[model samples]
Target: MMVDEPPASARFVVIGGGVHGLSAAWHLAKELTASGENPNVIVLEKSQIGAGASGISGGIVRNFYRSEAMTEVIAESVAIFEDDREGFGFHQVGYLAVVPEVQREDLEAIAEHQCEVGYESELASGDSNCREYLEWLWPDVNSEGVQAVLHEKRSGWADAIGTIRNLARHAREAGVRIFEGVEVIGLGYSGAEVSEVITSGGAIGCEAVIAAPGLWAPAWWQMQGLDPLVTIGEGDSAEQRPLTEYWLAREGDYLLPGVGLAGNAGRAAPVVHFDHTAPLYSDRDGELITDQPWGIYFRMGMTGGSVVGGGLPLEMGPDFELDPYGPENPKQLAGDDLSEFFTSGLAFALKRFRGASDLWDSNPNGGVLALTPDRYPVADWTAPNVYSILDAGHGFKMLAVGREAAREILGSAKSSLLAPFRLSRFGSGATHVVSKSPYPWT
Candidate 1:
């Protein structure tokens, strides 16, 4: 169905219609509607909803943070995922993070802290599941070395497309208008404030403008004479890049259906295979191989008894030019890089776990995605009347910024929820990045 355009006297004009953009429009529309004003909120998307990262994510939702601020804000988001069922379809399948035999003690200490704060995690042993994986899992613990899997029963994945679409639908029901397939050319700034947004469609006047362009933020920044650090490269490279060189990915975690009795009472649990690289991460620009033994696995998603695991974070290759604004090239871009990365993980899984990486098959990156600096996320106010939200490397789970961003755009008085990610942190001489575990799980 074709969308209808609004007259020049629109209430609010939003550019970019991803999770964050739609979230803002949804909340803001209701805010205006409640004030007895039939505010005409228009959201302009160059593509379809979730055409970028929001639609094609791994769909995991966990605050999993070493910082209190992140935890507190995400607490509000987690509540929406778990409690707001009619609004979105959320699944509590559970999450499992295995501790290597060598770093078992350190990881365990961190796990203890996480549990004390809000994580329901525990240490895993081989007997957690009497399966062949148990042989490789939790290989052996040397020293006070780590050899356990931290399990979080409350955290899990969700329906990415469903939630965003639901938000869009709710916004429309509340009298917000949407315009997809419309490209934003630039902004009409007067006295440092955006008066109107210039797009492929035409001029759209509004009381205020908010930009939640997500992966394509570089475009808007470039129009404003600001250059983003992320560069866009080709996804079709021929060079055989080492998996460990650019993306420190390994295949230790596979969704094994029926491993063992992985739960207590009604709670969900599964045996994790440690010892191996199911929990590989970036450390000193290489894979952290473990020699110790013993770990835990988990069986979540009651019906499917599914399993999940993560390796180390992917280090931006020296060749990786962080250009999020370059033209769409086909020679050697992240798409091919991800293709190779996923292929490598699958092949490694075949040899290591005797299975495959299901992310591709499940359309994990089903939406457009991008990586941010510090590899966490950016959720802060930029110029006046303009705010931003980017989850760096952890955008999926960190999408709590969706509602938070919405609240900010609506000018809600209680947007104190977003003080943590204020863009000023970059220039305030504030080294507030959480103490990262030697494990690059970001």
Candidate 2:
């Protein structure tokens, strides 16, 4: 919120005031200050900080992933979040991922890989074992048809907006200038490198730039005359493809208002992953049958009710409405097809969530997530002096990704742990394959 002197020019400029951009600025300024260099760092935001998808994210953090790189980076991210100085309302309640018969083996392999990375996880098999574990952790949960369960002891959720604001505070303390309500309109190119960043306030000369545009990445790429992504032997090899759009899944909250529920107090509910299929019951259409299986995650003690969401991927464009918090936003307060699927499916799965559909705020609301070809983030140098910190949909990992990217930018570290997520991966055929996990961003 405070900009010291407000330098007309800075050495490093970060776009977007979300978690990733602020993290980059904070870490970069910290590294520079520690090295006695004291580089001028600036962060520009289009709207308010965390106004993008990061503000409405479920804020669940975990180290479970089929890709070794993701597993490793997320592990480091947990460490960073756990550090009290970061202070994003971090809790270590742990993450429980339940799987049915089809995903049993895949979940086991993933759990084993996670253990190898020094992340301790408990694996419970059979309905009886899973039911026992679920009851032990969450007494009210209905664990039926759960063939395998993977519990990560160290992973859990955090306060999304709180995390972003805290990171901004840290950045300011480190002498990084953050200007809110300032929109970056364009980027000035100097033949081979990005020389300046054009903004609504004014153009700022910078030596380097890190664009963490979030959902506006497609628009940013198009403005720079480059495509969001280019795949090999897909469509036209020479032509570039638009960045994939993904609608974030959101659900209602369960709240008693004055008195608190058992596991709903102090976020007592641990992060949960429901990989089992549920019977989709609709009031108007009766029991609706669909081929696609249902996968949803929820945890108790949000501002309103228990947060529940996660279904199949829905594709859309970048120009869709983004203000889910507004009173008039239909995506925020309207109960549509997606909301029906989430509420009904949740009611069928969890016994405590029987009447959650009607008790909630009537609508499911979230923001748009910029998706990549491999369904992961890309943290790499795009041009000579321009870098990108785009998180495909895993916006929660921005804390660790920002720290690593700053290390790379400061030349303190060669290639950060996220080297696997470089932009070249799509062209080199080094994409991460999605496992049977309910969340594709994992």
The number of the candidate with the highest TM-score is 2
In candidate 1, what residue range of length 10 has the lowest lDDT sum? Answer: 237-246
1-442 per-residue lDDT for model 1 (tens digits): 6566645647677777777777777777777778886767888888777676566444666545555566566666667666666566676755555444444454455566556667555545442332232333323212122345556556766666787887688778878788888887977877887777788878877677767776555556676665454322233432222111123222222333443224333343332223343533222233543432322222232245333433333454524433332224222123333433333332332233223334332211112235443344566666676666654544555445766776666666546667756554444433234533443432
Q: What is the clash tally of candidate 1?
A: 44
Global local distance difference test of model 1: 0.53
The true-versus-predicted C-alpha distance at residue 337 of model 1, in Å, is 10
Predicted structure 2: lDDT: 0.73
What lDDT score goes with residue 116 in model 1? 62
> In model 2, which runs have C-alpha deviations exceeding 4 angstroms?
1-6, 233-240, 256-267, 282-286, 289-291, 303-313, 317-328, 331-340, 355-363
lDDT of 2 by residue, 1-442 (tens): 6543335689999998888898889989998989898758999887888887788777878766767788888887888887863478886778878888878887788888888888879999888998898777656667887888898988887888788888988999999888877878888888989888888877888899888888777767876778655763333554455555555544444342332223533446667777765555753345674536667676655564445454544555545565443324655432466566665555655666565445444445554576776778888888877888876877675588888888887777666588888877777677786777656566
Each model's C-alpha lDDT? 0.53, 0.73
